[model samples]
Target chain A: MTRIAVSLLYAGALVVLIALPQLISVKYYLHLSILALIWLIVSQGQNLIQGYTGYVSIVGAGFMGIGAYSTTLMGMHLGLPVWLTILLAPPMTAVFALIVGYPSLRMKGHYFAIVTLAFNLVIFIVLLNFTELTQGEAGITGIPKPAGWLEALNFRDREVYYYFVLAVAVLTTGIAWAIVRSRVGQILMAIRQNEDLVGALGVAAWKYKLFAFVASAMFAGLGGALYAHYQSFINPEVFGVAQSLDAILAVIVGGSGTLAGPMIGAFIVIFLPEYLRFADSFRLIIYGLLLVLATIFMPRGIVGLAQDLGARIAGRR
Target chain B: MIEILQQIVNGIAIGGVYVLIALGLTTVFGILGIAHFAHGSVSMFGGYLTFFLVAGQGIPLVIAIPVALTAGVVLGMAIELLAYRPVRKASHINAFIVALGLTMMVEGLNLEFFGHEQVVIPTSFDRVFNIGGVTLPELRLYVILAAALLIAAMTIFVERTKTGQAIRAVAENRDAAILMGVNVRTIPLVVFAMSTALGVAAGIMVGALFAIAPGIGEGLVIKGFAVLILGGLGSIPGAIVGGIVLGITESLAAGFVSSAYKDVIAFLVMIFVLLFRPQGLLGKAS
Candidate 1:
């Protein structure tokens, strides 16, 4: 009953937020919403590895880049359907993640973070230098939007695309929540808390970390595909370290270990800059200051804070 | 043979900068168990300050570097005191988050003060020396010398001095160091100041040899961490060797193979090392 009530509240909030772009009629807000949705998906993906499994991946944007470039190239060159490209991109990203994560994930904690950070750097360089395939910094432009069966309904509109992205976002979060609540999530948390103990229990620790890493990559790829199709342009910069850090920041600030945390984190990280447009230059200072404060004061994140308040109220009762 | 030597020389010069950056990071991580992500940005800030002093303020490169290094020391101390000290005993994740935040703040501050334009310090040493057909730039030579000097100085400080012994004591066992009258709290400040000064020196080298921009620090920090991992975290000797190894590999890969694959190849090597030897090249197996 509580879960249902909580989900309903989330649905209501999501609906209100989705309706906002339409009601405000501001192109900027629409753009911001689209960005938020992109970050929402990315943050959720990051949460899978960082929050749920307790492995810090600083390369979320690299996976997103793979998805973006794969979808863009396939859609543009191979003349594949946008939808098909979206479906295929995640697997492609997963394969890359598996290869990279195989050895990289063996190193726990700070070592893992460095490895992922290296991955991000390498991926960015590849995207920038592979001129023949990636168009070298010029970026692949004029990516086609979803058409055919979906196009028959005139889903080309920004509002329509917003709804489409929100639907995927909802579905992805649902899947994520389900996974986190399942046995796999339990195993993941166990690994996070005590990998040696998990290994003693006969669970192949590396296998589970690898699984989480690939799954996280798939989510990043899915988000990247959506972003590519929505924006109709892709660049090397999209997969750079800054974007990856933003994803990690979103996961951290949103509240790790909770479903709603990444979503809220995505909202704040993506929307905060938009809202604080007047402080343009000093925006990063504010962001940095906020992150410091959040880490110190609300280490459990906003969701954790809310839960703490609720627990206090219940205790008083 | 000549080409290999040239690449080796090139790598060594670049490796010197990496060594300085990694030294700062290694000290902090080794002593405090905190990942100082902001070290790169702070280093860049030092570089930018040096550039401003040289070009904008009309100070000589020699005078500007010391000023910037001093500023770096102060900034490092300030970060430890203001940003990290309060959350020292908190969760490791707290320090991690603060590190990320401080990285952004420093990068933003650099962007604001330096503007978005890339700045390079104008040095008088524009001459290139041809040693056995391997062209070595004068500025790069100076960078190598300066880095060696700093490394030697740091080694003496850590190995010979009483304060350095205290730092080593603290790193080995914090509680015991505290009991032994090591003044554990002041150690982090000292570590940060030294580290930041080294990072500033590297930044100045980059400014003179390459350039300084907003996101460059982020890239440098990543590389520094890579060196950290490759050398074995918290090992100063490992940092030096790892930085050189990474720098040489990157240059050789870029020169021989594809520049695009330089980073990819370097990381692949690190990954391979980690798979076979998880403790890194110099790191002891826990």
Candidate 2:
């Protein structure tokens, strides 16, 4: 009953957000909100591995690239339906995650981060140099929009797509929340705290970590597929190391452990810069400074900070 | 055969730079247990400083190299004191966060000062030396020699000096070293200084050999980490061996196999290494 209520509340909140662009007249605001939504999906995926499982992956963008390319290639060359390509991209990226994660997860701490970092570099190079297939740095342009049944419904505007994206985002968030609330989530938390203890308890820690990694890659891939269709273009930069680092930064800045933390962090990471566009060359400098300040003061993230405030209020009462 | 040898020679020259970078990273990671992601950006800053000195101010290369290296030492000390020291007692994640933040800040600083265009430090050595039909650029020869000299100096410092003994002792057992009256606080500063100087040297080589740009550091750091993994994290000899292995493997793969898959091939080698020996090629079993 609680799960149903919580999911419904989330769905309602998402519906309101979906309707926001229609209510507002600002195109720039809508654009920023769309970017926030895209980042929210990626960061949420990041939170699965880094926040829940404690394996800090820096290849979120690589997975995104995998999905984007898969969808774009399938839709463009194979002439597959958009829905089918979207379905296929996540699993494809999952396979890649498994391949990369198997050897990488053997090492702990910074080793894992570095291996994932290398994965991003390798993938980006492939995307750039594979000119015959990927069109090189020029990127694949004019990717078809989400078609068939959705297009049949005559919903093609940015407003209509916003609802579609929001619905998927909410559904994925609900599913992720459910998984985190389940026994599997508890095992992940246990692994995060102490892998040896969890292994002693008969849990195959490596398998669980692999599972989290694949799942995270799946969501990132899904987000990328959605983004490719939405943007109508696919580029190699989508899989660059900087994009991967930005996703990790979003997870860190927004709050890593909590369910809503990645979402909040996604908003700050995506939208904060848009607001600070006037800062020009100083924008990244400000961001770097903000990140340092945020980490020092709110190690737990903004969601964690909010929880602390809520606890303080309750204590005062 | 000639092409293969040429590629190998090229790889060795580039591998020398990776060696210096991996040495810097390993010292900080091995001794202090911090990932130090900003090492690459700091190295790039060193490159930019060298460019500013040699190109802008018209200083001789001899004077500029030491000045840039000195700047690196000061920057590393500042990073240890300001960014890392504050979160010494906190969760490992705090340091990780700070490293990421520092990386962004330094990169941003480089962009602000250096602009986006790739900058190469002008060198007088434009001649190519060929031996047995294999050509070696004079610049690459210098890079290789300079890297060798730095490595030797670093090895001697770590092996022979009292401070090096203290550093090794701390890395082996920090609590034991503290009990032995080794000044633990000063060790991180020293480690950072040494690491930064090594990174600065790499930056100088890169500037002369290739060019310095904004995103170049990210790529170098990834390669450095690859060396760290291939050689074994925290192993000095491992870093040297691993750096050479990776550099040579990447060049050979690019030359013989496919240039497109060079990075993939290098990582595939790392993955294979991990499969057989998870501790790395020369890394002691953890």
Candidate 3:
């Protein structure tokens, strides 16, 4: 059956990812893979909301920043283990989402988009101006890595962190797949198709929207927590609208409405620029042109394009 | 009182810039229902172009401006035809994607062409005039007058011209306008052209008044959107009033509260306004 083939493919991918750093042996590639995995975590959360629930939350980077700061500051100043801080940070980040989502979710479509953008702006402003706490844009450097048994895993090694991130990526994707297959996914997809119909069917659209928003906030937070520890520094700029745009670009380029989209998107978003290091200064020009061309010519994204191609070949047989 | 008056004067100049941005944005959103996020980058492109013509090529401001304005019109038309026309009947998200992509493309172009340095268009309007207690610089005065003149011109054109009437007709009801013999297809082109022209005018003012560099367009576009919401989406007069209100609010907030969070305060004020009037200040309550 196709299901068996798909699971086998998934296992194969997992094995390949686990062996990626070992095969490549290049530290730069390992670093890039780690970055892609981090983005994958955030984009999956972004996919859940923007892709499935059909609300474009542009504030994912802001929540990610919140998580980064929470874990970093807590681990550094409070002397708590980085693991516990990461564990607690996501829930704390979600609390902020609850506050913002209640008011912002009242607006529909693009209005919500702008409101979330404003929230991100607000976070950026606070991060920069709250000099006493956030270090006033100089950024917190030398953030301690995970300690105790987590550090015993030798995360200081680039290869070890790669596996660590891969595990998280797999877990995150698994949870996303599980959710997408459940009744909740059906309701979310229905809302995307027609919120009025969902509401008419007695599904309170707001509650479901809030739930997805909170779930996404947690994902962003987790990604941020891991990123801060891995990168060993944090800054307000990392949480700006540009970072959120990168998430959007990945989701759209990979295919927004599919589970497979964000994973593929993370690779393109991170690697295309890396591959085009020859373009040097003009890298973003090609990047921008690609964004416009892809959106226009293949609005369905790469995953959707692949699906169409596969269907055609299968039908030919 | 003098400080308050001074702040108001300062706010009005920047407000004039906001009004121009909102006018361009409102035109596209009003008629086409596209957010046109690239309008800001296009506006910045206008600034960079004028700067190049004047500063780099050693051309006069008078000559450079018209050339930039014309280029803006052409670029605006190209955007409609190339980027937006194909996805006209598709989902709104398609246009949204186009807008996002166009913003990046244009921003990328700006960076590649203009580099990362902030350029201030050199102007000789250095005379400072002190009236009563408040001091008014020659540059700010010219900026305000220029904004007023442009607004008046846009109003007259939209109110009196036949093309303008057709544009308005399309916005009011597209199918009805088509039945009434109005060429609906050309309206987007005209709207984008006029909108980009207005944005160019704003960009020129901004370059002259402050400076222009990479990423500034993003902030301007956000403010323009805020003005759109504050004034009422698709309402020209609303854009005007909302822009002025936002500009003044930003000025006052910076002067009294904290200049560090000046941008945040503006959006916060907008949120406060929306809390009470969800349709925006001049928006029609549905």
Cα shift from native, residue B57, model 3 (Å): 2.7
TM-score, candidate number 1: 0.96
DockQ leader = 1
- What TM-score is obtained for chain B in each of the predicted models? 0.98, 0.98, 0.98
The C-alpha stretches of model 3 lying farther than 4 A from their native spots are: A148-152
- My TM-score estimates for the predictions, one after another, are 0.96, 0.96, 0.97
| DockQ of model 2 vs. true complex | 0.65
lDDT of 3 by residue, B32-56 (tens): 8888889999999999999999999
Would candidate 2 be rated incorrect, acceptable, medium or high by CAPRI criteria? Answer: medium
> What is the clash count for each candidate, in the order shown?
0, 1, 0
lDDT of 1 by residue, A110-180 (tens): 89888888888889988999899999889988888888465445556888788888889988999898989
Report lDDT (CA) for all predictions. Answer: 0.89, 0.88, 0.88
Looking at model 3 chain A, report the run of 10 residues with the lowest lDDT sum. A144-153
Model 3 docking category? medium
lDDT of 2 by residue, B27-59 (tens): 998787888889999999999999999999999
Clashing pairs in 2: A254-A265
Give the worst 10-residue stretch by lDDT in candidate 2 chain A. A147-156
Tell me the lDDT of model 3 at A231: 95
Candidate 2 has an lDDT of 0.88
